[model samples]
Target: MKLLKLVPDDTNIDFMKWRKIAFGISLALMIASVVLVGVRGLNFGVDFVGGQMIRVTFTQTAEAPVAKLRDTVGALGYGSPSIQRFGAPNEVSIRMRLPKEAEGQTGAAATMTNAIVGSIQKDYPGARVDGVDSVSGKVSDELFQKGTIALLAAMVAIAIYIWVRFEWQFGVGGLAALAHDVTLTFGFFALTQLEFDLNIIAALLTIIGYSLNDTIVVYDRIRENLKKYRKMEIGELINLSINETLSRTVMTSLTMVIVLVAMLLLGPETIFGFTAAMTLGIVVGTYSSIYWGAPILVWLKVGPDSFVPVGDKPGAPGRDREGYTR
Candidate 1:
């Protein structure tokens, strides 16, 4: 029986051939992402915005009346409520932001939850209250601040670690790729107006780790090849390293994407944004490892001589295009 190969062992695609174009597109997207975030902004959920969340199930209905429920809740003078089905079709989660004055009042959330639940139970009998949750304005403000700090801290720490593990240039390249992945994910949420919450934070952190792992793999190969082929041009050497790791990269990314896509289509609605962010991360992370991460080495002056000994150049060894000694 023969084994499968998504990328053949002898493959030598010139990934760097599109480095300029890729970076051009990346710059445009990053700038656009910033603009989108600034203009459209993120649609924060109850977790960060401090709100009353009520969960209920309509026992008699096959599907929750989303439109009617919206109208009913909207008329409550509680403003618009964010409602979405979670597990079963009859169940839904409703989130209502608290007013500034109401935030300081005790049992305010409970009062609002009771009112909404009462209205639903009266109009539609057999409505069962599942649970209620609340967060104070101060608490949500703290949460938002802490989440921001956590993301920034994680990215900076990853950059510092890469700098220590590899070189400053590699660290810069890795960090740039991370920023690109994260920023674009944020942009997607802003554009689509998905609920940005603690779950999305976890997804961002996961994406950082994923992008870093891919960067380290390609950088490690580049380092090894630099020492092995001391006479190879930096461009060709970087291209070789990327192509060498292309098979593993493609396999790992494909596997994750398949699982994530499945989750996105068939999984629960609560994790939809999480899955979407990861799906986008896998794609951008793989691309950065190839085009953005590896090619940046050339611009930063990394070459075959980078890993050479301090004293003297070693004897020139004749090597084939595949990086093997002749």
Candidate 2:
């Protein structure tokens, strides 16, 4: 039986021909993201900022709506708790920043949770607290530090892996593409003021893995073609490699995007930020694999000689008569 084909097996598209244009666009967007993040900052969630979070579920459908919950909580003098539907209509999560005086106070979170629960239950009978979590300022600071370290560590590991597996040029290109995907994803979160929590950090790491896998695939093909087509120009070889993997790339990205879109539209508000970030990452990752990752090889001056053994040259170290790196 014939297999399904989303992109032709014999594709010959010149993807690297427009590298300059694509680079320009990516640079502009990255700079804009940096500016937005610097000016507006991220909308950190309770996990990153000290806060008390309460999840409540109503036993009856006659419970108050979201707006009423907000109003009810607001009237309690907590300064308008951030209330939103959690997983279902009957479930809601209320988050409030800890007061200055309440910070570092023992058992403050539990006492606050009890008070909020009591206040809400009075208005809507059968309403009970499903979960309660509290983060202190010290804990939040530690979390932020660890999260940043994890991201940097992941990037460094990826760069080292690529450098060892391929040449330095390929490593640089892969890092560049990963950086582009990550920056754009962060930019999306910053521009939209999405909650920057641990889940979103997971999404960012997931994006790094996905984008790196795609870049490696392209780099592998380029490596093979460099040895086979010695006369081909670097630009032509890069384009050929991308076209060769275009079908697989499109299929993988499309499959991921379909699932991510479903989650974005139907998933709970708690994971909306996660799904949105993943969706953006998939799109950006695919584009960078094609346009940003492979095209950087040209700027790095990676030619056929780069892929050959150092000992292949006459009088080089570790020379061998059979042309193999002895």
Number of the top candidate by TM-score? 2
Local distance difference test, per candidate? 0.86, 0.84
For model 1, the stretches where C-alpha displacement exceeds 4 angstroms are: 55-94, 98-111, 123-131, 312-326
What does candidate 2's lDDT look like per residue over 145-188, in tens digits?
89988888998899999998888888899889988998888788
Instruction: Please identify model 2 stretches exceeding 4 Å from their true place.
Output: 1-4, 55-95, 98-115, 129-132, 312-326
TM-score each candidate: 0.81, 0.83
Q: Mind sharing the TM-score for model 2?
A: 0.83
Clashes of 1: 0
Candidate 1: Cα lDDT at 61: 94
Alpha-carbon error at 171 in model 1, in Å?
Answer: 0.8
Pairs clashing within candidate 1: none
